[model samples]
Target: MTNEELQTLVKTISIDVFKKPFLHQAKHNPRLRTTGGRYMLADHTIEINPLVFKVHGMDELVGVIKHELCHYHLHLEGKGYRHRDEDFRKLLNETSSPRFCKPLAAQNKKSTSFYIYECESCKLKYKRKRRVNVQKYRCGKCAGAISIQINK
Candidate 1:
């Protein structure tokens, strides 16, 4: 979608969900890598990953918009807007917004250079040169089950 479309969607979601208007810009940012979306504290803008709509479709895109709107509305009103803040948490719960944006599929398209391992318990991402034995060797960080990360 175009930037204008994103702005309209963000504004609509802000009003419908939070009962507040989003006065700032909402545009697709090509630079975003891992995160689905981000709210800018400095400019009061919301940068959404374009790959979200292209890859995941509208339902997932709406969820991300809701998540970012929580930050945008709360921060503007001088309430607790940070992810860890009580007000932010309460608003997120109230609006049924996801605690965090879903990981973009674009981010999972890993290259074939190195093998990646993730700890099941701690969710710590690790990259290694050698193949890891998941059964015999546990995670170095949490002593949890180690599994290879397969791109999906």
Candidate 2:
């Protein structure tokens, strides 16, 4: 969505959910790598990760908006707005906003060990992140026995 649309959405959500009008800007930020959205303490602006709508769909986008709104409203009122604060937690629960955003699908990478297996009879290769029992796992190419060729 364009920045203008985002601004409208944030404003609407603020009034609809919190009974407060959001006066600051809300914009899509492509540079946000690890968060779905963030509330700017300096400007009261909200920057949403563009990937939130593209990857998580509208429901998730709204959740992120609500979450940021919680921060925005609470901070403006001089209430505790940090995640660990009681007032922040209370507002989040009252608004039914998510405590934390679901991780974006695109960033959920796990570091793993690589295991390469080769079939003894067909020479078929298989790459797996976790080790497999060679005795239990066989090659699909020829129903042949498999052995690990490399581990890294």
Candidate 3:
């Protein structure tokens, strides 16, 4: 959704669920990778990861907004706003907001490069995250000379 839509959604959810107004801005932040949404302590703004709606749909997006609203309302009222705080926990329970969001699908993929080492004699294979020195290291199974295959 566009920034204007996100802002309106946040405002609506804030008033409907929390009985409080969201005066600050709410927008989708492309830079947010791991989190569904975040409440900025300094600016009082709410930033939602765009992938929430694109990947998980509207229900998940509303859950994320509810979670962030808990933080926004509690912080503004000068109550405990951290995740571990009693007031925060109570507010979450009262509002029926999710304590954590489901992980994004794109985040669960393996993207790192790795190396495969094989024994020349025994044909045993091993995987290593970093490069192995084939000239010095021998296979553990047969003490045979090693060969390397790069996997990206």
Candidate 4:
């Protein structure tokens, strides 16, 4: 959805779920990588990852908006707004909003190649994402020297 639509949805959800108006901006932020949405304490703006709607659909989008609104409303009211706050948790339960968004499908896929290391004495094998210094590290099984093979 466009930023205009997002702003309207956030405003509507704010009033409907929290009985408060969202007086700040709500926009799609393509730069948000690890979070579904973030409520900016500095500007009181709510930024949602566009991928949430595109990948997870409208229900997920609404849930994310509700989560961000929880932070927005609580902070504005001078109540605890952090995720660990009692006020935030209570508000989330009252609104029935999700505590966390589901993982993206793309993020769930692992395409990583691993470096395989083998012990010289025990033949124990290890897998690591990055190259390991075989000379410095020894096998836990037999304290033997290790060798690295090209990533698979």
Candidate that scores best on TM-score:
4
TM-score for each of the candidates: 0.69, 0.71, 0.73, 0.81
TM-score of 2: 0.71
* RMSD for each of the candidates: 10.4, 8.4, 3.6, 2.5
| Residue-level lDDT tens digits of model 3 in 1-152 | 99999999999999999988999999989998888999999999999999999989999999999999999999999999999999999999999999998887645657676888888899998999888778889989889999985465
Model 2 over residues 12-123: C-alpha lDDT tens digits? 9999999999998899999988889999999988999999899888999999999999999999999999999999999999999998778886555677779999999989
Tell me which residue pairs clash in candidate 4: none
- Cα TM-score of candidate 4: 0.81
In candidate 3, list every pair of residues with a backbone clash: none
Local distance difference test, each candidate: 0.87, 0.92, 0.92, 0.91
Poorly placed runs, candidate 3 (over 4 Å): 108-152
| lDDT per residue (tens digit) for residues 66-87 in model 4 | 9999998899889999999999
